[model samples]
Target: MYCLNVLFASQLNHKSILKLIRCCLETQIPILVFESIEYETLADRNHRPSHPCFKPLLFTNRLKIAVEIANAIAYLHFRFAKPILFRIIKPWNILIDKQNIVKLFDFSLSVSIPKGETHIKDVGRGTMGFVAPEYVTTRGCFNEKCDVFCFDVLLFVLLTGQEITDYLRCEKGNKFYLVYDVKKYFVNNRVK
Candidate 1:
């Protein structure tokens, strides 16, 4: 098993971030860092989303992994005292060790809510493909549901193995329709 020789201990400031990492560590989730590469370098190459080796894993094991990611996000947003807006939720921000268990990394863009704030503003940021449409177009107020929207998009890409742009263009109307169209296409193609 790969071990993170240097833990990013300084980045673990928020309660949610600390808790999430703790749970993963306790449960023996493989989230070690490779000494040779920096997280920024991995993210720059889009290792999580577009890597050829990881692509197959997306198709074969995405559903289970998505569930785990959702649970992790849910724990941060709802279970914690102050919700954490993980502004960046792309696959690149997540790390996997030899065990294939996911560990979320890169806390550079993360934001924490105070006890009473209903929403956050002045933070216009997110990854490209994984960002929600409303957030991109309107730059309006957002909450945890915005992250959910991104999650849905990620799930679609993993299942279909098609670029998100293709799905968006080919499948029109609502987001649900788009997702349905992509899934249907994949299913039909597989059968043929």
Candidate 2:
């Protein structure tokens, strides 16, 4: 059964967003019916390509999906009266429908800050590489900004099919980290 929390169900009005067909709050479990999306998770597509000779995704399609993801994140972070933090934003967590529409799923890691609350204690519930540095350096102290950082990493991964480790290994000396690599590249036109 499709599951959608009340918080997200309210935002289903957006066109790019999925629509809720009905809600079932009767039994112990809560279930919300949404329009069925014929799709596969981006992670699955990457991990085990359905076809042996997988055709490369068009640059345009990748860009479109990236834009859709950004829009969805923007909406989630600011569109509502109360902002929502999508703690986990990664390609595997994204769904690509048959029509090539992107649907960001797996909101289990998401949290809703009370209208006036500024900083809630971080539980360090996030994936590696995609997680923000503040969540690491500060010992689980971070905010929505973490999502923005993750998005940047997501964009990089999408453009270059390279994992964070792979990118780091490509550096000559490997003294610079993932986040600093871009700046290093701009400064010396190389990763050091």
Candidate 3:
């Protein structure tokens, strides 16, 4: 059975295309359903402060959004009989309802681990900075940990109000790696 939740935002003007995937608990029957919802993507809500449609995301709301994202991912990873790995965990794929609850859509890139395996190997596919380096280096050999890595990068985007790839590209010019640049903050004790 596919675990599904439908959300109706009370006051959103723009319609967003979202992909919902239905999966069997014990088997991988990838079913795709297209639904149009009136809501804002997390990328827009977080980064588009100067836009006319911008809604100020409060600090408390940011933490709440983070927790909600975590809960959704946990359900996908642990609640399902066959664990689903959400290969892409970027802001663009995350939607926020009018009530500020996060709606995780776009299961197009998700994969379920085989019944007796700890990981799966596939070709890497994700946004540049959001994709984990180790995942790319191993040619898409990944498990649940890969999502965790990407989620951490999402946290950075939420906090900084900037997309990692865009920010790094503008600042560093040539080399713009999310993990490599984030590591510099930790090394220099700049993360406060």
Cα lDDT for residue 10, candidate 1: 36
In terms of lDDT, the poorest run of 10 residues in model 1 is 1-10
TM-score of 2: 0.76
Tens-place lDDT per residue, model 3, 1-192, is 133222111111122224433323344653334455677899989988778887779888888888888877776788667787877898988888767777777655677788999988888478787777788788878899889988999998897677775776675675657777789878998776
TM per candidate: 0.59, 0.76, 0.77
Which residue ranges in model 1 land beyond 4 Å of their true spot? 1-55, 58-60, 165-192
Sorted by lDDT (best first), the order is: 3, 2, 1
- In model 3, where do residues sit more than 4 Å from their true spots? 1-37, 170-173, 187-190
* Candidate 2 global lDDT: 0.68
- Give Cα distance to truth, residue 37, candidate 3, Å: 4.1
Deviation in Å, model 2, residue 81 alpha carbon: 1.8
Residue pairs in collision within model 2: none
Error of 1 at 4 (Å): 22
